[model samples]
Target: MNKSILRVAPMVLSTALCTTAFAYTVQGTVTSKADGKAIADASVSLLQKGKSAKTDQDGKFTIHEDEQDTTSTGIHNQQAVGFVNLSQGVLHYSQSSGPVQVKVFDLMGNLVSSKTLYGTGSVDLRQGINAKGTYFAKVHVGSATQNIKFTTDGNASAYSTSKTKSALLKAGDTDKLQVIADGYDTLNVTLNNLDTTLALSLEKSIPPEPTYKFGYALKNTPTPSKGCGTNTTLKTDKKVENGEHHVVNVNGTNREYFITLPTNYDNTKQYKLLIALHCYGSSAEDFVHHTPDYDHPTPYYGQQVLDKNGDYIFASLQAVGGLWNKGQEDHDFFGKALTTIEDNYCIDTSRVFITGFSYGAMFSYSLAQDYQDRVRAAATYAVADYNIWLPQEKGMDKNLPIAWMNVHGVNDDRCTFDKAKNSALPRMLKKNGKASDGDSQFTDASSEILQENQGSTGHLCYDFKNVDERFPIKFCTWPGGHQWTAHDTGNMSVGWNWESTWVPEEVHKFFEQF
Candidate 1:
């Protein structure tokens, strides 16, 4: 753990003394529903502006916001559809205008039920519609349509989030909503008008995906089985092996994952674990093995050496049902998968790292934000967090902080690099005491500009250093499209394709510091 937490004591004292006692603030403690225990490090913020405060060791926190600072200029993604009356088996939703059309679909994109509501009412899954697994509820009001995805356990079902529109609440008036995640009880939150606590939660709801994999083969069957169970409710049983095609069951649904090991692996040795997430519509194995996407000249992974001794462990994870960090089940899937890896590997806890492409890249931030203690550092390529999610706490742990690096393309059309570097990254920096709107002192530190792809791309890197001199943030933006920059790092490479700006050696170097 970083002992720098001791150095921050003075700063904490200074902040408390500087703030006027009369300033308006909201104080409360956030506790988990599963156990009435204080949820340490939970975010207590004015949900709209993202002005947040971290809970103390006891889960108690005080958040202050200027009374005049309250404003909601954006439409909330998932509107608070009232409470879920589990006993009645009815979920109430609010529609500004009625005579609405509501439709329910399974994860396979097949419509299970449809209805036309004259006004805000309920979706009765209690009727012939209730089976386990994840479901999508589509509500069409007038010309406006809203789709809310939820998970259930067969007996009862509820959406993962609840939110009230910005226009409905008063600036100083406080309101509370209950978030009913499947397999978890409601997470009731007290929200001040300007702060959008629940608003951010609903944005995570997912639509659906075409393919699904869990524990290697068909649904919940053990390995070595071809044709398996018939039910579509997400569920699985898995085993970890080379090219095992593992499946992690979340909320009774089977989510898929894959793993790759270094050549010289030993259980007694401590090794770094790199969790590589694939881009949307991509395979888990392609990034793990060289599928011939390297540049003619020197390339990041495609051309780099592939046969290095097992210095680290590399695991590639396929998104659950083709979704990554988009829903409650996805979050559960990530944590469960990580637990699966740790139980099986002799991982060096201090060096657990992650990197992703596009959608995977965007979700990496969430992994670091939510699992900071385990995720030492993160790097990415392409679009990151199109819908920027604020941190629940400054760092998952103030002392055990995780670093981030971004590698994107300037001329790329898929995900703009400027938006990530100039916009999203700074917001992330703000969480680390980058004063709001303050000019940052990032050095123009681009290194080993690929010797092969010369003049074709603008390769540059920016480093954000911390108090301990452990560079936590590195930004590598090049003149290319959405691609991973894997290059030759003396030792063997982690197999790469042509669309790269850096190498596996460089990537390992960036993370070795943690």
Candidate 2:
């Protein structure tokens, strides 16, 4: 065939020598719903009625529509709900051309949802709808690949299922209910004033853990301890179980927490809760000399492992004077320490997880935007931008489904891993929906497979090295700078160069298959 048309003639003259002005191209092939095969990085998205895209490795993707017309924040009716609230500035994408795995079901076929893939040809998908219907997408693209289906039309799912607490309810017959979510549809609100309807759907498929590791696995049953009083200690053979040091009170203040229990904890089984934030003056027993309770001596990059064996419950919070930017109404003091650790332990509301360092990694980005329904996934180190600590664009909540990990140190100069690892973690992964386009449809041919490097602060490390071990944000750089190198429980804090086989077994293998 004429040598495969001259090797695809430079991808067809680079897709007709660059087409934009609201461009569009979504060639497909992400297979493996159960058998067929051909999925090599399956995360192809293009859900326009609003926006989305991510597919390359060959599955292919290319989206570019934003002819301005901007005005999204819709959901008018219900007397415009409360004082009427809406915000915009969205467009997310990720798939520079590597991993792509997507499996999300609802039209009855079962399977619920799954993600973790990285780029191919075109990638952009940050669709955060609140109300709409008909969604049954599946793309496995590997392991005998052969699964791909798409549909999305109910209109932002009726404005994200409308019912923000009955339009921000506030006393006067508080029962107005209508909050659906099962296979997907039914949002007709009026709660307190009476008028029901809550049959919504889509959110069921999290039972794969025979061995799909990521993070969290402990059950409570330890008995070793040696430090937690004066602070400042480094690794010492490693071993300090005891964990449990509350002071609680929250929102008003009092803070100081550290509750690790899971060697086999029992009161009738009920684990899964994680919160580890420490930076400023750092404490919680100096963030356990760097986690896994690094039997202290003066550690920062000590050493620790063993995560996915099972029982997980860890908490190490402390931030008030160790302020988290101290603005947005004091950032609900870590949601009152997650409501006092989900009202005293036995939590698992959906495997809560959080991690911070460096002003607690900008307070884990304002608690993933005001505790996105009590957190699900978040990992940060050397935070990059919170608009220099909570700039304008306030109160955003797009259905809150999160999965992000941002680490910096491209030779940080007090947070400058190229603006905290390439422009504030890809603009907060397209404002949390997971990539589409936020800073205006990005160009330079959507960042030419990135990977540049110069650092020493002058800046330049566009990086994207290797990702999609289930939505990864891995970026590395050493030659030291800011400090505290991995002592969170991987150890190496002399002059700092301790990446220690990269921490938490790759964050428990990316949330144990998230």
CA RMSD, predictions in order: 29.4, 31.4
* Every model's TM-score: 0.43, 0.21
lDDT of 1: 0.49
Q: How accurate is candidate 2 locally (lDDT)?
A: 0.42
What tens digits encode model 2's per-residue C-alpha lDDT throughout 330-352? 46656665666555555665557
The superposed Cα distance between candidate 1 and the true structure at residue 185, in angstroms, equals 56
Candidate 1 structure quality by residue, lDDT tens digits, 458-501: 45565655312333566665555655653322112354344443
